[model samples]
Structures are given as C-alpha cells and as structure tokens.
Target: MALGMLKKKRDSKMSTDQENENEQNGNQQNGNQQNGNGEDKEKQGGGPPKPVGFLDPRMKHVRRSVAGKWLLTTVVLMIFILGVLSIYWACLFHVDQNLSSLVVYVVDFDGQVAPYNTSGVTPLVGPMITDMARSMVASNEPTLGWGPLPPSAFDYDPIKVRQAVYDFDAWAAIIINPNATALLYSAVQNGNTSYDPLGALQLVYIDSRDDTIWYDFMAPFMSSFMTNAQSSIGSAWTRQILQAASTNTTLLSNIAAVPQALSPAIGFSEYNLRPFYPYQVIPAVTVGLIYLIILSFFSFAFYLPVWMQYLKPEGHPPLKFHQLVVVRWCGTILAYLFLSLAYSLISLAFQINFSGGNPVSSSTEVTSTVDGNLNPDAYGKGTFPVYWMLNFVGMIALGLACENVAMVVGQPWTGLWLIFWVITNVSTSFYDITIEPRFYYWGYAWPLHSVVEGSRHILFGLHSRIGLDFGILIAWAAVNTALFPFAFMFMMYKNKHHLHEYWA
Candidate 1:
C-alpha cells in the first residue's frame, strides 16, 4: 500500500512539471509572434530608406516658397525703373539746357596778321580767339553744376586734353591754323573772280561725350565762334577787294571788265547745323529698352539654375544641363523681343519728337521744312528696327555669356559686379562734362553709345554713318558669344563633382 502511494505522488509531480513546461513554451511562442508583428508594423510604417546626403526638409520648404520669385522680380523691376529714370533725367533737363555749350576750346590758328612775325601775330591771335571763346561763354551764361571734376575749366594739351576728353572736360577743341584762314581769304578772293568760294577748314572738334550742363554752355559758344569766324573771313576778303580797287588802277579795270568777278558772291550759307547733343530721344529710348531687356534676360537666366535644382535629381540626368542652358537662352531671347517691341510701341504712341520726325514712317522726308536741310537723322527708318532686333539678339547672347560666367565663378552675385561695372563705364555722369577731357573715348567705346548712335542713324534715314557704330556693337556681341560656350564648358567641368554628389 505504501509503494503504490509513492508511485502516485511521483506521477503527480511529473504531470505538473509537464504542464508548466507546456505553458512556458506557449508563452515563448506568443512573445515571438508579438515581436514578429511589431517588426512588420515597423517595416510598414517606416517607408523605403532614404538615400544618403538628402537635402534638409526645411531647406526644401524654403526652396518651394513663392517669396524668392517675388523678391527677385521686385529687385529686377526696381533696377529697370532706376535705369529709365536716369535716362529721362539725362534727356529732358540736362541734355537740352546744356546743348549750347557743347564745344569750349576754339583755337583759331587762322587769323589776319601784318606779316611773317608769328611772335606778334601769336599774341593778337591768341587773345582774339580767347576773346571769341570768352564772348561765347558770356553769351550762353551757363550755371555751374556737379561732376567728377569742377565745371567750366579747359584742358589744352592733347594728352591732357585727351585725358580730359575721357574725363568729360571740353567737348571739342577747334584748332584753326592761319593757313586755313589764308585759304579762306584766297578762296573768297578767287570767288570774286569766279562764282564759288570753295575752301574746307579743318575744324578739330574734340567732343566731350558727356551730356551735361557744360555742353549747354559749350554749344552756343561754338555756334557763335563758327559764325563769327566765317563772317570775319568774308569781311576780310571784301576789305582786300575794295583796297585793291581803290589803290590799283589796273586791278579796278580788271574788276570792272569782268562782270563775273565784280558780281557779289553770296557768303557762307549755313545749312543743317549739327544738333548740340548727339543723342536724341528715339535712340535714347531704344537704348533704355535695350538695357531693360538685357537686364530682364539676365534676371531670367539667373533664375534658371535655381529652378533647375528642383527638376534635376539624382545622377546627372541625360541632356538635362544642355536643356536647361538652351531653355534659359531661349526664354531670354523671347523676353527680350517682347520687351523691345513693347518699348517701341510705347515710344511711337507717345509721339515723342525724336527730332527726325515720326519713327513709324518709311518714306518720311529726311529734312525738316523750317530747317530746309537734311535733319540729323537720329534713326534711319528701317535701320532702327533692324538695330533693335540685332540688339535683342546680342542681349540674348550676352545673357548666355553672363550665365556661363556666373557658373564659372560659382557665385551668382558676381553678375551684379559685372552689371555695376558696365553701368559705371557706360554712364556719362561719372566723368565730369566740364572738367575732364577724355570722355569722348569712353563715349565712343561704350556699348550703349553705339546702340544710341546707331539707332539714331537708323531711325533718321542716315544709313551712311551707322556702319562703324554697328560694327562695334556686332564685335561686342561676337566676343561675348564666343566666350560663352567656353565659359559654360568650364563651369560644367568645375562643378561636375558636385553633380553626382548632391543629386545622386
């Protein structure tokens, strides 16, 4: 009976042990299932793994915002408005008022003197020319104004004068040799024997390329001097003729015998006086438009890279860079064309007297009735439109050039420096119109000047002189265009590493 009871107890203990082991195994299985479920949930919730070097979330948000676009547009528009204001200020008040005093130094080398003694003649002639210049200054009554240098001063030496010419002092120097005057006297005497006094004088007019109050002071002075010089020559000839007739019986007889010689010959006939300011409204307007269009193109081109950053992702996409550049240039060209046309339309609608008459007419008379001579053709009808088109093309090319340069520098802000430099170099105000002398060189070299001058010739039907200006403009365009592809290639090469690193 005791053996049986012990066996039962052992059996019971075995059964309990088995039950506990089963329960623990079931618990383990449940825990494993729970862990597996948790892992599945994590895998489902977490999403695909992000690749390395992802852009920051906040940065992406900022990039997507419209604020940047608005800011860029606003800045561009402000710059454009400023440029327009500058042109308007230069045209209306500064150019017109200062038109009369365009030329300041009139050196008359041709004045009457007693004999071969240059010493005696030098003092008299020098004072006489100086007096003529002073008289002209007195007649104009120019008010002093601000410039890079002081107003109303003349620089005499060619080198000094050239420097001043660049600096904007003394627009023109009239070097009149005594031989020229003698030729005029001889021509006048010959005309008394013939019908025409044909003598050409070398008027060395050093044009100060600046448009300012000093030009106003110089123009009238120049006009007066020219008139007085011609009159003086005519009067001198008359005096000589009368003296010969009075003193020489043979000369009087000859004069009386020849009706053609004795007949009164008309003196210098003034026709189509050159405008005081070389630049007029239409050309100025065209230039302003060109500036605006180019700037707009640049702004658009500049934004292209920013936009591209969003489109291009991962490994350098096939043809993506090429497409971006082409798109940029194409967009720039389109924008330039639109802006140029708009500007032209606005200018025509306003009927702003560009001095050559209606810019819209093709068969428009070249000469003004009152003036009765060929008005200085500011624009050569069809030529102006062609110039504007060419300008648009050039600006687009420039845009590409700027883009390539910006990419090469690896900084967009460098373009602002370029723009600043261009503006500084092109603007006449930086050089003193009255003090510095070499402003003409600066003027002639400036792209804007060519545009202005060339446009004038085109609009005014004066096609003859537009060649040089157009050539210069074309040369600038060509140079910039040639540099663009190389610059772009360099940028591509330089930034090649960044391409795969960031996007990939």
Candidate 2:
C-alpha cells in the first residue's frame, strides 16, 4: 500500500509540471504572433486590424512577382501617351489639301442669257470670272471646288442662287448680275452718276455654319480671288475706254463725265446668309459640349456606390446577374433623364435663343441682309424638349462607354481610358470633318461628333441632320448596353477570385 501511494504522488507532481510548461509555451506563442508582419495585429482603441507595409519580409514574394507587372504598366502608359494624343495632333495636318470639299458655285446670269442681252453686247465680266475658275480646276494650286455652272443651273434667277446657298446646296455662290456689263456701258455712255458698283457681282456665304472654315479658310481665299479679278477687270476696262475715246471724240467728253465708273467698275457684294451672332451661343454649341461629356463621365463615378449597393444584400437576398444588369440600365437611363435636363437648362438660363428665325418671304432678301439672317434658332417653342432629349441620349452614349471601360479596366487604367476617350472625341467632333483628311472619316460614327453636330443644328438654326445625330447616339447606347452585362460579369469574377487584388 505504501509503494502504491508513493507512485500516485509522483504521477500527480509530474502532471502539474507538464501543465505549467504548456502554459509557458502558450504565452511565448501569443507574444510571437503579436510581433509578426502579416499576422493579425490587435488595435489599441478597438479599431480594425491594419495591414503591414509592402517592404515587410512576409511580402517578399509579392514584391518580386509584381516587378514585371510594374514594367508592363510603365511601357503601356508611354504607348498610350503617344497613341491617344497623336489622334488629335494629326487631325488638321494638310487641311489645306482638302480645300476642294468647299464647293463654291460660280454662275453667270449677266448678258450670256436671254432678256439681259438686248444690246447684243458681249458680257465681259461673266465670262472673265467663270473662265478664271475653270482654268484653276486643272492646276495643282489649292482651290475651292470652283464649279462654274451656267445660269441655267440656278434657273437663270439670282434669287434661286441665294436660296441654294441657304439650303446648304453649296458652300458659296459668286453670281454675276444680269446688268453687270449693261450698267458699266450705260454709265460710261450716258454719264450716269447713279452707277452702283456692288450690283455687278454677288458673293453669298453663311459664316455660322463653321467659323473656323469660314474665317480661316474660305474668307481669305475669296478675298484674294475677288481682289485679283477686280484689278484685272479695271485695267482691261481702262484700256478699252481709252481706245474708244481715240475713235470717237464724243466718248472723250463722256469719259470726263463718268470717269469714276472706269476705275473700280465692279465690286463684290458679300452676302453672309447666316452670321454667327449673339456670341453667347458659342459655348452652348462648342466648349460647353465638352463639359457635357465630362459631366456624363463623372456621373458614373457618382452613381457607382448607389449601384454597388444592389450588389450587396443587407436585408434581402442577392440580386440575379441579369436583374442587376436591368437595374443598371434602367437606373442609368433614369439618372441621365434628370441630368440632361439640368444640362439643357444651363443653356436656357443663359438665355440662348430657342426661337426659330423669321422665314424669308423672298429668298433674294437674304442677299440684302445686313447682319445675315437675324434672330435664327432651330425649333422655336419645342426646342427645349428636343435639346433635352439630345443631351440625354448623348450622355447615355458617352457615359455608358465610360462605365463599361471602367468596369473592365478599373482605377488607374480607367484614367487612361478617359484621356483616350476625350482626345479621340474632341479631335473628331470640334473640327469640320469635311476639311479633315480621309483618315478621320471613321470619326463620323463617334458619339461626340453626333452631339456636336446636333447641338449646332439646335443652337444656330443650321441644317437639320438631327435624325442622323440621334440615330448614332442611340446606336452607341445600344452597343454599350449590350456590353454592360459582360463587363459586369468580368468585374464580379475578378471580385470573387481576387484577380484585381494583384495590382489594385
């Protein structure tokens, strides 16, 4: 019994020692965990755990693995800088070479036709200008598509010629009036002091259609051409009058009476069919459209958190993938509906006219206009609704693409995509594509181009290509809508598998 008792006591003492060693080992293990790099670090004031720095020894493999990715990122950025920016930089290269796109109709309505040729006198002015334009057609020099047509093309009516310009049938028209040579001969023969020089020739053009093209390209060319023609005609007429004076002393007495008519015997009447007026409309149609694009792009960022709320389910079950897509589509459209209204109101608030121009009772009156078809607007009372709808569609077109790209690319890469988006759109939209090189033809299908064109139609009472504009915008929205589901699916897959965690 004594030996058994001694054995039990020894077993109890050894068990106690083993328990104390286990307690000490547990304390050592807890202390080591608290001091670790990647291991959980307890917060002092009950906050969430903080992550270790990238330089931590525990992240050694992660650092090494991301090295090649960093190099790839820098290389891609360099390429993007050049590739995207070059699109805009090259937009206007050799713009002068495409001058033939601006077709200026040259018509001779003077003595060449019926009723005006009663004197059987050769019309010197009409043939002179028309022949001059035809000669330039074959030359390698930069020339307006100088399509010198007979008076029959415009029904032998100068009024019809003006109407053709107003209807955008031609960029400009140089019309020789029926009395061009008649007035010159009568003035010199009858000694008439009432000879109007501006009645000899007419230049009809619209400045509002494109200020850059008009002021920069078209005006300068027309100026130089008209000046040279006037100088030549004046010199020729002076020599003819002197020769006539030598034959008839009667003509010498008449020359002394109306010698002013022989100097600048003819002049061009520049009738701008539509002028760029009220300067305030410049922003409504031009740079303000850039803000419209920016507003649309940022809308995605603003509404993302709200949309993402649907991705998480706090009180209800998770939404189906397709249902979420519908949510995104409906939600985005709803947002755009309101946002576009706000944008349209900004133009309205500034009192940019939405009233249609007074209809010309006689199209010939356009040539007599002092300020070029005053008080012009596209759609009087109904303009606001149409304008709002245009902006709504444009926003959807631009914003949807931004969202889809951002979903696929994510943060830093999305920034690059925004730059790419702005450059491509601005290069194509802001400038006249007719003057741009053939390479920019694809810009016709771009979203901002449609928006800019549509805005001009609305604001300036220009041509009505709104149908085509809305069609393009809707097509863009439809395509981006189709891409929405796939982009979101990719995003979700990245989230589920932690694929974005690599670089994000």
What do the candidate models score in CA lDDT, each in turn?
0.47, 0.82
Best by TM-score: 2
Determine the backbone clash count of candidate 2. Answer: 0
lDDT score for candidate 2 against the true structure: 0.82
Error of 1 at 386 (Å): 2.2
lDDT per residue (tens digit) for residues 391-489 in model 1: 555455445455556767765555554655355434532333323333334555555555555554444443334677667657766776666656655
Find the candidate with the highest lDDT and give its number: 2
Alpha-carbon lDDT of model 1: 0.47
Model 2 residue 477 distance off true place after TM-score fit, in angstroms: 1.9
Per-residue alpha-carbon lDDT of model 2 for 1-504, expressed as tens digits?
999999999999999999999999998887688666344555644666667798977778889889978999889988988888988898988677889889999999889666667777778888888888887787879888888988887777888988888777888999999989888888888888888778899999887777777888888889988998898888888889889889888778887887677878899998876667667778776778888778877887888888777657698755666777788879988998998999899888877666554564343454222344433567777877898999999999999999899888888788788888888898888788888888999999999999988887776667678999999999999999999988987877876833333221
Error of 1 at 304 (Å): 0.9
Off by over 4 Å in 2: 1-71, 247-250, 357-375, 497-504
Residue 256 in model 2: lDDT: 83
